[model samples]
Each structure stands twice: as structure tokens, then as C-alpha cells.
Target: MAEITVDLIKELRERTGIGMGDCKKALVAAGGDIETAITNLRKAGMASAVKKEGRATNEGQIGFFEAKDCIALVEVNAETDFVVKNDRFQQFLTHVAEQAADTKPESLEAFLKQSYAKEKGMTVDEYRASIVQTIGENIQVKRLSIFPKKANHSYGIYTHLGGKICVVVDLEGASDEEKLAKDIAMHVAAASPLYVNAEQVPESVIEHEKEIVKSQIAGKPENVKDKIISGKIQAYCKENCLVEQPYIRDDKLTVAQFVAAKGKEEGKNLKVVSFIRWDVGQ
Candidate 1:
């Protein structure tokens, strides 16, 4: 019979997040076999699985993968910052991103149901469950996206604060224009624009802002009130629209103007097609 050492008990406790005494007893019951002990703990529902499920997962790292004409971004979340730094969690996130890149699933539900190709006969959700059992935290795949290059298009990505924020941009331009795309992505990270252009701003949003601005200036003359509302709407668009916002690098120019100037310099018809930004837990 194998002797159950303290080190074995400690390892089990770390993996399962169970109490010290329970880990020791489980190890003893399994004759010091770590794998069997883990099984017993899980079967008996003494593992950290159920208790951790209801906890909010506000801490996580963004996983990313890029290939020729394709890119994927995934946000996998856990309950604590400590788990965010765990190597197993990081590895799992990387695998999730890679799977997104390969499969291009349309939605989060579909992505989880897809088989985890690296592991034999395991769905992504199953893999996620395995990770929860190992790390003893509520693990979730929050969101993911795949950006595949369209005809005559380019892509760029930027990850900030060690994946707390990520930006992906798609542009219609020459192949050598990836640097411009990357610069735009960085600007998106800083500016946090909600729409690509003034035209993309919804009519309802504009109406809502106008109502707020009108009420604030209602004491003024009727003619002046209209002008003030118009000005406020323009300012709102400038602040909220990506193309209308002032360039982060050069306040003298809007993002649209910056792209146009760069395009002229490179003799290309460059334009921003679309963009997506993700901030963890937002």
C-alpha cells in the first residue's frame, strides 16, 4: 500500500479547493492515488464545483490568435484575479481563442457546443467544466469573435493592460496598410467610440440626446434653442462616432481625416470598414 504523504494531500487540496482534512481523508480512502481521490471528491460533490458556480466572474484575460487573413479573440472569465494569473487558465483561454479562429462559430452557444479539437471527444463546455474542477473557480466563456479578411481588406488587433481591453479593426485598403490599421485599433482602444461614423449613429440615440439638450437650455430664446440643440448633436456625434472623433495622435484632425491623409500619402483608397472593442466585464 502506498503511504499517503502530506505533499499529496496538499496537492489535492490545491486542485480541488477542498478543506485540508477532507483532502487527507479522501486521499486515504483512495489509497493515496491522487486521480482516484479527485474522482471521489467530485462524485461526492465535495469538490469546489457547485459552491463556486454562483460567484460573479469579473476577472479574466482576453485570449487572441492571428493568422493569415484571419484573427480570433476570446474572453474567458473567472471569479478571482488569482485565477486569472494561473497558467492553466491562460492555457485554456488560448485554446478557446484558437478554436474560435478555426471554427468561426456564429455565436457563443454554438462555440461552446463545438468539439474541443485538441481534446479527444470533449466539447468546449466539457473542457470548461474540467477546468472549473481543476482550478476550483466558476469559469465562463464570456464572448468571442472571428475577423476574417474580406476581399481587398486588412485587419489589425491591439490588446491593452494585459488583455483587460482588446480592439480589432477591419479596413479596406492595400496589403501594406496593416500599420495604419493597427494605429486605428490603438486609437479605438483609447477613444472608446460607439459607432463607426456619424451615419451609423441611430436616430433614436440622436433624438434622446436632443431631448436632453433641449430641456437643459429651455429658458433661452426659441430661435437660439434650435441652434444650441444642433450644436449639441454635432458634438455628441464627434464624441461618440469613431470616424468623427478627434484623432488620438493629432487632435487637429478627426479620425476620418487622419485616415484620408495617410491614404493620400500612400496613394491608396483607405477606409475603415468596421471595428470591435471589448473591455472585460463590461
Candidate 2:
């Protein structure tokens, strides 16, 4: 390795879309040549089998795994959402997730440490590295969410556009309604609701919205603050609240109103406890 220069680091970042630190390190090992740096990183990711570790990988796949009482939905991102459809990466994700069902690793590190029988005796991390070389982008396990079903509650899962996104919802007060469950799951998939209700949204998020609203009203008179605050709260609720969001089927009414009407007509009690959405390109 040689002494890496700022220009070399900048050039490598531009060429490979990798982070500055990684680019410089690669360049140092490659005698400060941009092309050599790219080759070095590629080889490193190959032997280690994982490249571009933690570089805002917003691409990959939405994987689904369901067990007796537990349902898991994951969003694995690569550098580009286009790679979400890559056969190699998708297969790797499916294999890893299926293995995750039986292997109870407390954290991702532990999970990676659990070896795979089909992996030619490579650790999970090594497997990931090999897969990344084939895919040629920074890959990350962006989101991993598990929903457990209680005796009274039920689970539903849905994915769209070949794993472009995934949605999982917990429906409470089940009444032997498989179709309704699927419908709610698909609704979650298509609508991509942020939160089930206003109460579920974190206070920090609410405070952030309030700050944005406050800034918008900065030039307004002091007497107008209360009115601005009230309007801003309404806006915040509208954006974050699932019920306040317009139904994807028909924008005439919000999901809350739609659900209420349907529940009334069906003579069934149903409540959405929580919802999760993972958008592939987002």
C-alpha cells in the first residue's frame, strides 16, 4: 500500500460510488491508482465475500418468511433498486431468510456467524461477500421485522412488483376472516401507510413535523401562531395517520372512514394494531 492522496480518494469515490474512507483505503492498497483501487475493493469483497459494507444500500429485495406463530418480512437493499430483481441477490436473500427461521441468532453478527450447509463451508458474512461481488453493489439488510400472532390476533403479508416493497400488518380480534386479512395485507402493500393511527407515531416525529410547521409560520404574526399550529397539526396527522390517508381504492374517503364503514356493514370487529411498509426504491 502507498500513501493515498485526496485526489485519488475523490476519484475512486466518483468511479465506484463507494464511501471516501473505503476508497482511500483501497487506493492506498493499490498504490494510489483509481483503477487499481476499484479492483482491490472488488477482490477484498470477494475473498471476504462482502463488499461496500454500510453505504446506504437502498436496493435489494423484500423477503417473506412465515412460521407457525411468527411472520417475518425483510427489506434487503443494494445500491440500486434495480438490483432488487437480480436473481443472485434475491436467491441469496431467500436462502438466508429461510435459514434464519431455525437459527436464532440474537443479532446480525451472530446470524452471520451461523454457517450454511449449502455455502461451501462459508460463514454468513462470507456468503454475503460472495453474493455482493456477483451483484456488484453495496448490499445491506435494510429492514428486518417480525410479527408474532397471539391467540386472538392474526397475521397477514403481501409483496408488490416482485419484491419492490413489502407490507405486514397485525389484525386484532380475528373472526375467521382470511379474505379480510388478505385484503388488509394488500391494502398495506399498496397504500404504504406510515402508522396505524396518530397515537402510534413517535413523539420525535411529531415534534419534527411541528418544527417544520413552525418554520413555515415564522414570518406570520404572533397572533397567528395558534392558528398556524392548529393547521400544522392537521397536516401532520394527515401525512402520518393511516386513517386520515385517502384509500388507495378510492380517494373519496380516508382509510379510517373506509374501514369503519366496512366493519359496520360486515358486523365484525377488526382493528389494525400496527403496519409496516418497506419501499424498494425509497
Candidate 3:
């Protein structure tokens, strides 16, 4: 058997544009012959898939998975909306989301190296490459996020526009109120709040808002400027903070007040801990 050296693997990778692991394996299987390895890769369609890798991937869907211990959201991108609607692409996205939820990989690179859950004898990235070859488009597992379940914490998940937009809200309370949590998640999807509350807003961000407010009220009296700035900041928080924003279902009550009212009915205290909102191509 021929020894498969680093240089040989590198040459194969340079020729194929495939992953190092795949390149090395191909080299070894071909007895360290770069031409033979390239032939094998081409026969398997991996080499051809490399041609589409550089294409723009601005259309795709978000995949959501919920497990007993954690929840996951994955954004997979493709070159066209037509590919996004393909059955195989949708299946691959679902499998990737489930993998993220099950494995809780710390990073996208780690996730790609994981074994594909629905397929045998293949890494996630390998499966993705095969899909690209089949679909004849650039496909990418863009990003993923996992949220671990916490005691006394319930999650509200809402998917909008058939997963073009997805939101997950973590709520802390004594009892699980799924409907309330989901309502908050829906509010998050619709309102697009950056923070859970006013206090969560960074001081730098507040200062920047103040600077904008000051410039807008430049001609105002000096004594009234401070009060006006304070008012403007307060309004900014109300609009940008999830809890402070008016509830989408009932504009009369702020999101925080709505949660509090629900808590009162449930005989427990409730608060929004954090949330994640994802928009496709964003």
C-alpha cells in the first residue's frame, strides 16, 4: 500500500475543492494517486458539486427542532427559491435541525463534522455536498443556535411564513403556560425587539440614542432638553424592548404587563428571560 502523505492529500483537495477529510480518504482509497482520487471524486459527484459552491445562496428556509432537553434553529441557504421548495432540500434542512438539537454542537464547524442523523456512513457536510450535486445549486448550512432547557423555564416557539422567520422566547415562571409563551414568541416574531427590557439595553446604545435625540432637539431650551432626552430614551426602550413593547394581540397592554396579567391568573410570577429571532437572508 502507498503511504498517503500530507502533500498528496493537499493536492487532492486543491484539485477537488472538497473537504480535507474527504480528500485524504479519497487519496488513501486510490493508493496515493491524485488522478485516481480525482476520478473517484468526480464519479461520486463530489467534484462537480464544488463548481456550485461559490454561487450566491440568498434563498432558503429556517428549520426548527424541539427536544426534551433543548431546542434548535438552523438556517440553510440555497441559490434559488426553486431549490428552497424542493422536497430533498426541505428534508435535509429538517435533518440538520434535528442534528443540532440532538448534538448541541458548540459551533457550525463542529456541527458539519457530525454524523448525519438520517443517513448512514456520512458526515453532515458530505451529505450536504451530495444534495448540492443532486440539486445542482449552491447549498450551505449557514448557522445554527441551540438553547438548553432550564428548570422553571418554558419556551415559546413560533414559525412564520413557513419558516422564513422563526422566534423562540425563554420565559421563567413557576408553571408552564405554553399558550402564553407562544404568544410572546409570536409577538417577538412580529415586533422584532432587540432586548427583553429597558435595563438590558446597553449603555452605549442608550448614549447613542441620546446623541440622536440631542441633535433632533438642538433648538430646544437647555432646561427642557434633559427632560425631553429622558422622554425620548424611554420611548426608544418601549419600542425596542420586547417586554416593554405593546402586545401584538392586545395593544392596550405592554408585553410585560400582558405576561404579568397571565402570571396573576396562574398564581405565579413570570418574566421574559431572553429570545432569539431569525429572518431568512438577514
Candidate 4:
């Protein structure tokens, strides 16, 4: 059998985040095979996976990556804010974002299993685990969003407060309006509209808003109540929908109006196709 050395124990400790003594014991028991040692530690319930599994990872950064054909956003969470600022953590976040943009996985689970772009033969989740070992915190790639580019459409991507908030907007009917799209993205960062238009707002949400409005005006006459409720629901859509909301730069014009005015100047019919906004830890 091969003799376990100090260097071997250190490597195991670095990979598993297990204590030095436990790693040494596992290495010895597995005859200096790192993979086998990891398995043994896990079977013994003494690995870092068990130790860090339950920690709340409420803090981290949202990373944004834009490719020629798609835009990707990834949220990586850690146990504390301090780790988010670590050089290793930031590098990991960037790599993961790029990986997401390249692979365009359909879901978070699929993204986690995709190969890490920076390192060959390593899955994204494995890379995350390596970072967790280095940083000594619970790290997770919480979510991923990918927006595929459409022909004759422009995309705007914005990151605010060092990526605590990231927004992406898709605009149709013009290909050269990147600045317009970016401005809309910035507005989204500020205004936080929930849907692109009133039509996009769900019926259930409108009904819920109506319920709240009706309860507030319960003493009004039944005939008056109908008119007030209809007006209030319209107002609610104006507040929550992107196209109907007042533009962040000019409150006098709705976002839809602002886009339409710009489109008229360019002799094109512009439209807000869709938008996505991600707030860290939410």
C-alpha cells in the first residue's frame, strides 16, 4: 500500500474543507487515493458537504455576460458579503456567467452540470465546490437567466450597485438602437417594472389588485364602486407594467410613448419585446 504523506493530507483538506486530522486519517485509510478519501469522508459524515450544507447563503453577486447571440445572468450566493468581494469568488462568478452564456442551459440544474468553461473536465458545480473550499463559505449558483437574441431586435444589459441588481431589455423593430435599449435597461434598474405591458400582466394579479382596491373603497355606492375599481385597476397596470409606466428620465412621457417617439424619428415601429430584472438574494 502507498504511504500517506503530509502533502496528500493537505490536498484532501483543500478539496473537501474537512479538518486536517480527518483528511489525514481518510487518506491513510484510502491508501493515499484522494478520490477514495473523499468518498470515505463522505460515508463517515465528516466531509465539508455535511458541514456547510445548512448554512444560509443570503449574500452574493449577480454576474452578467453578453455574447453575440445571447445574454446570460447568474446569481452566485455565499454565506456573507465579505466573501462576495473576494478575488477568487469574483473570478468564479465571472467564469460561471460566461459558462452560462456559452451553454445556454435550459434550467439551473442543467447549468450546474455543464462543463466549466475555464477548466476542462470539471463541471460547474464542482468548480463551485472548489471555490467553497477555498473561501471557507457555503457557495451556490442560485439561479441563471439566458436571453437569446432575435433578428431585428436589440438588447440592453445593465448592472447596478456592483451587480446587486442586473437588468436586460429586449427591443424589437430596430437593430441599431442599442443605446435606446440600454437606457430602458437603466430605467428598469431604477423603476423595477414587473411586466412589459398590461397585456402581459396575469389575470390573477389583476384580480388580486382589484380585491385590494375594492376593500379600500368598500363604503362607496355599488355603481360608483365599479367605475372606481376599473380606474384603479388601470392605474395598477400603469404602475406595474413597463410600457405604461412613466419614463424614468421624463415623467411626463410613458415608457411606451418615449419608445414610440424615438421610433418615429427613425421611421420604424419600435416595441418593447420583454425584460428581465434580477435582484440579488430575491
Best by TM-score: 3
Per-candidate alpha-carbon RMSD to the true structure: 8.5, 7.5, 1.7, 6.5
- Expressed as tens digits, the lDDT of each residue in 1-282 for candidate 4 is 677888888888888776686678788888888999998766644575546856999988999889999988999998999999999999999988888888889999888877787888767776776676566888988999888899999888888998899999999998889999999999999999999998998999989988998889989999999999999988988988999999999999999999999999989999898999999999
What is candidate 1's CA lDDT for residue 264?
91
What are the per-residue Cα lDDT tens digits for candidate 2 across 120-147? Answer: 6777656776777766677776556556
Worst 10 residues of 2 by lDDT: 46-55
The window of 10 residues in a row where model 1 has the poorest summed lDDT is 44-53
| Cα RMSD, model 2 | 7.5
Name the candidate, 1 or 2, with the larger TM-score value: 1
Q: What is the lDDT of every predicted structure here?
A: 0.87, 0.70, 0.91, 0.87
TM-score of 2: 0.68
In model 1, the clashing pairs are none
Most lDDT-accurate candidate: 3
TM-score-sorted candidate list, best first: 3, 4, 1, 2
Supply every candidate's count of residue pairs whose N, Cα or C atoms clash at under 3 angstroms: 0, 5, 0, 0
Model 2 misses residue 146 by how many Å?
A: 2.2
